[model samples]
Target chain A: MVWNEKAECMSREEKEKLQIKLLKEAIEKAYNNVPFYKKRFDEAGVGPEDLQSLEDIEKFPFTTKADLRETYPFGMFAVPEDEIVEIHSTSGTTGKPTVSGYTKKDLDIWAEVTARAIDMAGGTKKDRIQNCYGYGLFTGGLGIHHGGYKLGATVIPISAGNTKRQIEIMKDFQSTILTCTPSYALYLAESIEKEGISIEELGLKSGIFGAEMWTEEMRDELENRLGITAVNIYGLTELMGPGVANECMVKKGLHIADDHFYPEIIDSKTKETLPEGEKGELVLTTLTREGMPVIRFRTKDITSLNYDKCDCGRTTVRMSRITGRTDDMLKVRGVIVFPSQIERAILKIEGLTPNYQIIVTRPEYLDEIEVQVEATPSLFSDEMKEMEAIERKIANKIHKEIGLRVNVSLVESESLPRSEGKAVRVIDKRNFD
Target chain B: MKIQQISVFIENKEGRLKKAIDVLSKAGINIRALSIADTSKFGILRLIVSDNKKAKEALESNKFVVKENDVLVVEIPDHPDGLNTILGYLDDDKINVEYIYAFVSNKTDEAIVVMKLENIEEGMKALKEHNAKILTLEDIKNL
Candidate 1:
């Protein structure tokens, strides 16, 4: 198995001290290497000496999504293009996509980190893993694939779609482990039941699902349906994809590969680091990336940190399941509403489904929120009055939960578009420009 | 005879159509026939309704992005040649049909063709010259 000497047995105090050392090293690297970072640092009138302790970390300017946008394709890479072995990017709904790169050493380290994550999730070399995440520029598939291979598992690269074929490969290979998004996993389980394939008949045992937000209720449902344990994996294209963290068999929270990537929670507004267990924005600093070394990269994902030791015997700190995104938070009428909160409200409704849209429009001056929910087949009926009543009920529930009144529209099931990649959650038409 | 034609701009998202329907229903308007012209991001819902003024007011008040426009409505035979005859008339004059939609009237044994034209006045004249019936606003509402 791929293992790092420094991470495996390091004490908590040693890890913390090591992180401070690395943060200073990363700041100096940015100051001396990248022109963009240099300009920002010079303009801020800050030097390496200013970063004496973690308290001074707030002195650095917080990087925004706009900064990533300003750089565009590969402008932020600290190393030369010739040194970069691979390039990955996230798609753009508004403008050009944010690009990232990896050197050969970086890829190797990523594979090692992923392997460690797989081990944390209770996978052994004896298990045959079926990976359904998409590859190419997308990180999910290749990230998990490299990790599974490193762990010496027979990896089946069934990268997204064709659920039937995925099932066939799983059964034929007697695959014991699966790695894909939670949505796709649910879809696969539903398809298996529809096809009358018993879960017991397939030797599948465990799964690692990520790349989109899911709830605890969803995890329970998936576990019950797939007849296996499901673990949550976390990462982004900007931070080297799915291996930045993984949940242990305990499934309490995702364990961060804290040795390679330092994790900190920060107040989204003030950019101040919060104490552990306080809900805030996740900030990551890569200690040992080669191609594009990042220093204090602000990942807009909102979650808290857990330093409690796990029963699995790993000393790495864990992160709670992502509640939502700092950017994804919808500010309407001076109220901060997350789409996930609406999703939670909708999921609690007996006949409502997960497919929905949060539309924010500026008809007058203030922003108005409208939730268009898709009614499951069970909720659809011949009676028009019943459907209207259901809509009213849903609207009332949303109002009660979020403390904001919203217009609710009950759309037919499958009426909402399905995404093959990241699901588009919010549609803001408030003239953001 | 006055008929109201309304165009609504919509995105390909859930609840949009239902919201439109809700707005129209609240205004006590009945849609005679409707067509959706869709691209990826936005869709235009064009409707011929019994209460056009009410429908337009309700849509605008509810903040639905909409526009009002006029298109020539022509009555045609129910048979296949009904459309070919109209196209044949326009083709001879070198006038092109940009887009079109239709609703067949069961009792009347006729269909209505709502056509957008390159030249509206000339296109209507060419159709009238061919002895085809150009539907008035009253003709559409009665159906």
Candidate 2:
């Protein structure tokens, strides 16, 4: 069920050769058309002609989110305004969002990579795709929709929210493939039971989940609850939506579309590309994008690259699951801790709900963190001693997980806020800005 | 008799107890007996109100989590040794009281206390053997 088998199954040498040629064109296009890339390239004294081999990419300047933010609203488009057909943007927390434009051919390539993503999730033309990723302004919805259509599957553009309607349509349409964020998938799994709908009633073989960071424990929960193979799909609005990489059934790591998106791991602080298997920040270059060809864009997401061939028969380089973001990595009492690590610890223990919030504050000279986890009905006790014991158990578990002690508070049931999209779990009051 | 008490789960935030009280007050329900057990994180505010149904609805409408628990309601002498005398009966009967809170009954010169015992049925039996007067829901409504 491999989509674009020739491109996806190419040998390492062939793929590298293709990537080198595409990189030259992308660099030349970015230099010739986009003034931002041109000025930045000129200042670095690196021209398109300087790109002789793949190794020459190291000499080029790295583009960042701030750089993209500077060019808001059509400033980064490499193609003519009329040539650009589609546009998607991320919800920028700081006032204005970063926009991405795509030409018709660029849309075709988006569909192609998403098609490969759907194929990686074991979806085919016979499969019915119930896409709940969200449709407008965000790349998740339409990006996966394009892939479903390209894969020739029945794409149910159900969009997001409307939990009841989502389930009703899922059962009626007999959708075989589910696509949404991993958190949303988990919500649906829980909702299915609340609605009295058994897992066997709907035909869901696999789910392509991404758009937020989720742990392996969550994946296991989704897989068990939905009775399907839960796979991870990685993509950002800047990098052609959610078709950038996908996890095959092998469940090891996500295989990046090597020829389309040239992937590299780099030390975020040093800005130098790290060798294979070394964990660092991910930097991606859109080798074949026409509308907005990004040149070595620094994706603040933290992950590692595995160049080894996968058992799923794809030679595309795979990236380990994103562990933490360099920006969100918390330094508490000189100890580095990721919310994901704390989350892993919380989920590992029984009688604890997934809804939790981390509050970091600087009291005097020391930084303190309080992890507040919602107490489900089963976890709640009327006695103070029993409830305090629950809090202590969670705190000890977190200390063991992150190597840093934190105050654990067992808040009332359903006290924390629930998000339909990305959940904001951290409230940093350290005032470091 | 076993009286139904409403246990409200509240965060240890300022005005939380007042918020629950406000809800019950706005509903025109009279609170009979109340006790709060809390840690630094959260508190469980237990209440015996004129209308358990109405009080629960009011607090829950305000998005408070409420649990219905059973506890023995008995009348004791309204004196310095009243609470101690009731506990002596439980001790002599080998019964365990988890928590006990008292509210003066308007109908008499006695205090009606809510006893959250480890075994409600056994507590009622022991209190009955000691000739302690236990109040029912109807008696609580009248008071």
**Could you say which candidate leads in lDDT?**
2
Q: lDDT per residue, candidate 2, A1-433, as tens digits?
A: 6787788788999998999999999999999999999999999998999999998999999998888889998899997899988889998875579999999999999999999999999998999999998889999999999999998999999999998899999999999999988777877886798678999999999999998888898787788889999999999888889989999999999999888899999999899889999999999999999999998999999999998888978888999999999988999999999998998988887867677899999998899999998766566666666677877888888999888889988766556876667778899999876
Candidate 2 is graded, for docking, as acceptable
Worst 10 residues of 1 chain A by lDDT: A377-386
Write model 1 residue lDDT over A104-197, tens digit each, in one string.
8889888988898788767878888888889778888899888988888888888988877998998888989888888778778867986789
DockQ values of all predictions: 0.02, 0.37
Error of 1 at A54 (Å): 3.8
Tell me the tens digit of each residue's lDDT in model 1 across B5-84. 67775546788888998889878888877888764534567888887778877876665655666678888877979899
**Candidate 1 residue pairs in clash (backbone atoms < 3 Å):** none
Give all candidate RMSDs, comma-separated: 15.2, 3.5
- Clashing pairs for model 2 are none
lDDT of 2 at B74: 88
